[model samples]
Target: MNLETFTLFNFWSSPLLATTAEAESSSLILAGVLLSLAVIYLASKAGGELCARINLPPVLGELVFGVMVGVSVLHLLMFAEAGEDGSHSLIMNLLQATSPMGSTTFSHVFEAQSEVLSVLAEIGVVVLLFEIGLESDLKELLKVGIQSTVVAVIGVITPFVLGTTGLMLLFGTPAIPAIFAGAALTATSIGITAKVLAEMQRLNTREGQIIVGAAVIDDVLGIIVLAVVAGLARDGQVVVSDVVYLVISAAAFFIGAIWIGRLLNPLFVQLVNHMRTRGQVLLSALFFALILSYISATIHLEAILGAFAAGLVLAETEKREELQRQVAPVADVLMPVFFVIVGARTDISVLNPFVPENREGLIMASFLIVVAIVGKVLTGLGVFGQPGINRLAIGVGMVPRGEVGLVFAAIGAATGALSDALNAAIIVMVILTTFLAPPLLRWAFSLSEESATTDPASLSGNISEPVLVESERLQSELVKPEIQ
Candidate 1:
């Protein structure tokens, strides 16, 4: 070695300090992270398979598995997510049992490891919204026309107003948390509904078309609501002007980005066309999403919105199908992490009714569950001039909140906007609604099928056969693992 290098090395590695403590700490953190990931993957896959076998959305499996390994159960994974203390991580407990880590150093490692996993979960969600954006075909709504728009608007307004007002008046929930939960109620898990319709051979029916179109619109609207609520939730309190500004800003940002992105599509396509490297389209799309995520974060909106807008923009290009194909593997790798983390962070023990203190939360959860169902069920009444339309089926189709609801729950929890009882309440609503919708939708259709055939005029809405033929190609694809 050179004289200077030898002297410096000797100084740091004398008999007093032959070992690199920083390197050792880094190794411990890495080891802990790797072990946690292995557990998550195993649990997620097992849970996913079980859920899929039962004809349920596999994403449900991920959340259930997460709960099994999380704060309320096995404790294999833990985080500071939504007020959870990183120091309570059972992964850290295992690491300490296996290794000779000092208590102070162990605390540092656990906190650092938790931070890393939390960031990974954030990235996981961003990728999710990106993929969801790719799947959303706004043109499909063209065939369903104003009726679907009516359903979407009514679906959003009804639940939001009822849930928010009820929480404020009945439960005395703070405005921000109440609003966040209410906005969450506005989401429709179209994926679950889509699968049910396809299985029943009713995917192209008038009610199915309206449900699919409305669900897509609400998902779009739900993403916007998430952005605004997240922004308000972060500030710790909501103000009138701030709320108005966030609403306007989020709407403008999405519409403006899509508009500008369309104008620049040819240029984007040209850039991709000129590239000869591996993953040209996938990499470009991600680059665009990440850049937009950064811009959204800078402007006080959630980064997921930017990622979503990126997906929306790129989806308009000629490479949509290929881009979608390429995006799945990446999502498969990351999306489960986000779901698992949300489930792990959720402490459902608060929902137990036996405990005196827990009774209030349980009561609140019951209230939320009621509102979640009735609010969406009311949406069916919004459709005008379609007497043959199965309004009950349309309402039932919008019932499941699925992953989109969890997105709100996760964000609210992470921001500390939701109390433990409220978080548990939201989770209960999500799980039950997701489970209830598919079967309920089938029942709605079954009850209406005979009438549909008897009333020749009833089977037809403003929908044309040709438009529905094209829309079928879009509706038949159910919500995938991430968003359903």
Candidate 2:
């Protein structure tokens, strides 16, 4: 029963007791991949449920579970070296090894599988962004455009400066890692913030509108920064002309995508709606998103950006609700995969305070967390000139970095621009900000409510009410033609 002496036919005839090395190795790897998916989905769902029970975002639980099962804890998905005599390692055997695949072969297989999972995870984020765009009202967004832009600008600038300066001064880290730290800190996860706001029944509030609007603007700005930093990292130096080119290209892509998408949306919708097929509209919507995503990637911007723009185009159509309904199921399946992948990528070892080797990383993480918090808090002040607004609530609402921050950190790590220690620190900061924002925001809104309730005179200069009315009017006008 020597594996080296057996033919492929004999190995295929009895897969479990395969005698051919190639057949056995391939079968084992396939089984491992299937098992890994099962484990990841189950762990992610369980963790999400646990977090929900504790009144926290389910993503937190999913991420923590991923860390638990990943290399940092259970070592279930990590690839380790083979044993002596070129045999399969203990993990491979435990997962049901059929033959010895040397460490190199196993490593290659594992890496390939990981890349596949990563692609799936990225698609999940794209779907999530598309959904966000679908739910958004572009008209309302424009009403708060000025305020949102200011808040977004300040939010990006303050965090970037603080993150870069703090890392250089406190940790004496190299410039690339410091820049990445700053970039990571600039991400504000609108999904998490919007969910919390909706749960608290404040999504229609002025502060809520401002927070959501600002987050959307922040996303666009953050992507541009990421593109610039990635370019600088690749070239190993920031050429002034190169920086200008990157900035212009990014700007042109975003503006052009939105403008062209808007111009063509009506015609596209009309064409899709005229179709007699049952699900033609939904299919067309998905195709549109995928095509835009492809275009974004082709132009060197993130695909998610194109997906978001596609959603925006579809959002303006009369079939927006129908499109959203059809896409929801797909998003649900893939989005969790993205979050879990992010969690699995996080290395818990560097965050262990008890480990002497991790003490510096732990200290650096602590400092970054502080900076992340304070920097976003200052963004609340950008709401100046608007009365009766709880700036604190707005700022707190903007604090959670969530999936967007994770994406930035993942990019940095993948590019080798961020070291393990720095990546760990960024993740810690992301986790803390995400974990703390919900309760803090709830408390801030409560204070605002109490103040408004206790004093009738406190509403003298409230502008949100009038703006809300105007927003309602604008929405009515936009929907009037469809209603007819």
Candidate 3:
């Protein structure tokens, strides 16, 4: 039949089909998508309200909102217990009709949702990290001194030992498994610490600098440990050759990435300098991030490390603030998708299975949680230069295991090292860390600030005081207002 005849014939045959087809039409789906967007936006606002009331980060609220719309929760909320299995519910019918045929398969649906969530979550993570990098001041970090390095080292060692011992004792897994699990717990989510410091107005303080510096070190240390763990897992034994290869390869990759970034940054800025339009500068920064990410991934490192390195390089440029401003909004909208997806992948159903039947899982999860928190907290003591420094606060600041921990566990799962229970435990750790860090860090910083205020000696006055003098001299010489 011709187009007009087809429409006319089917027009009234099934009102439901007709309506669905109409809804399936671009206009209808557009409306539905728009509605979804509205719901998500409202959800975000609701999250903000909950955050305000509970003294949690509003972003956490946004995360919870996403979970509500996720397949697990509210998606299931639409059905009565009886109708759930009958497949007669409106929402289910609509979802089935809208969902691709093959997508109805549980695995396929999961994979599709997973890919989408990963992308969104990554966007959130990238932007979040970018913001952290943007706010970082190298001079501030330097002023914090050997103390920060010491703190990160101590932090790394404590967690590594505790996690390894716990895994070995509790699970009696292979040596490699124990090593991988321990390595997973070693990295501190410095992003958490940085956010906390900023919230407490301590970002510019000496303690803040030490925490930030230690965080960077923690990243580097985490990667090194990850590489070692990965080598052991893959080789089944700590091969001397493999160890040397990984160490050399990682060392070379980082040094080379930095050298390359140094060279590329100037070239990129020059390209920006020659661009005809203002947006080109922003484009150049983005292009650099993409390139760096690709290069890092090519060498078997995290793309994030590359992205971070790119940001660090651009951080040195005069347009750092402008670059950050351009990147922030895009990152903000997309990054939380990563966190929400992380939550979604958790499969809380797994927890139900193990809870009463397998107390071992709960025991293991609790042990890991303690190791995770204690390892990073103890790292704070590494802030050694100043006597009576609030090392406890700094350590607590570094406690969350949001992204990096996930990366480690994911790699283990991918490689067949981590079993389902172990993987689930890791997910619990991630969720717990993400949930706990904001409030704990806030309290830690508040205590530090209170102490600093009460006693001038408690303030990071020694280093900061000198830096202010240098800043003034540079400001006077390097900047001049117009004589308008």
**TM-score of every candidate:** 0.73, 0.77, 0.74
lDDT of 3 by residue, 188-229 (tens): 766555655664567767677777777766777787788677
Highest TM-score against the true fold, candidate: 2
**In what order do the candidates fall by TM-score, top score first?**
2, 3, 1
Per candidate, the number of residue pairs that clash is 1, 0, 7
lDDT of 2 by residue, 1-484 (tens): 5766577656667865544655655666677667777778987889889878987666667777877776667666553211122122234456435544667667655655555666777898888878766776767666777888899999999989998998898788998889988988999987667766755767657787788878877877887788777766677765666556656766687678778888998888889868998889878888888898898788766787778778877899989888889988988788777767666665556667887766766788898888888999999898878888899998898899986887787788888898877887888888778767877887898898898777856565475689898999999999999999
Better of 2 and 3 by TM-score: 2
Name the regions of candidate 2 deviating beyond 4 angstroms. 1-30, 78-105, 167-180, 190-209, 226-236, 402-424, 438-484
Q: Tell me the spans in candidate 3 whose CA falls farther than 4 Å from its real position.
A: 1-43, 75-93, 98-110, 142-148, 170-176, 190-204, 253-267, 349-354, 387-389, 411-423, 456-484
Tens-place lDDT per residue, model 1, 1-484, is 9999999988867855425656777888999889888888888899889977886656667777888998889988977535554556778877777877877678778877888888888898788778766765545444676888899999999999999999999988899999989998998866556645754667657787788778766866786677678878887544667557766776687678878888988998999999999999999999999988998787667687788678777878899999989998998888778777766766667667787867766787788889999999999999888766789999999998876787788888899989977887888788778767766876787788777666657556535676888788666665453465
| Model 3 alpha-carbon miss at residue 83, Å | 25
Best by lDDT: 1
Output the worst ten-in-a-row residue range by lDDT, candidate 3.
Answer: 77-86
Residue 449 accuracy (lDDT) in model 2: 80
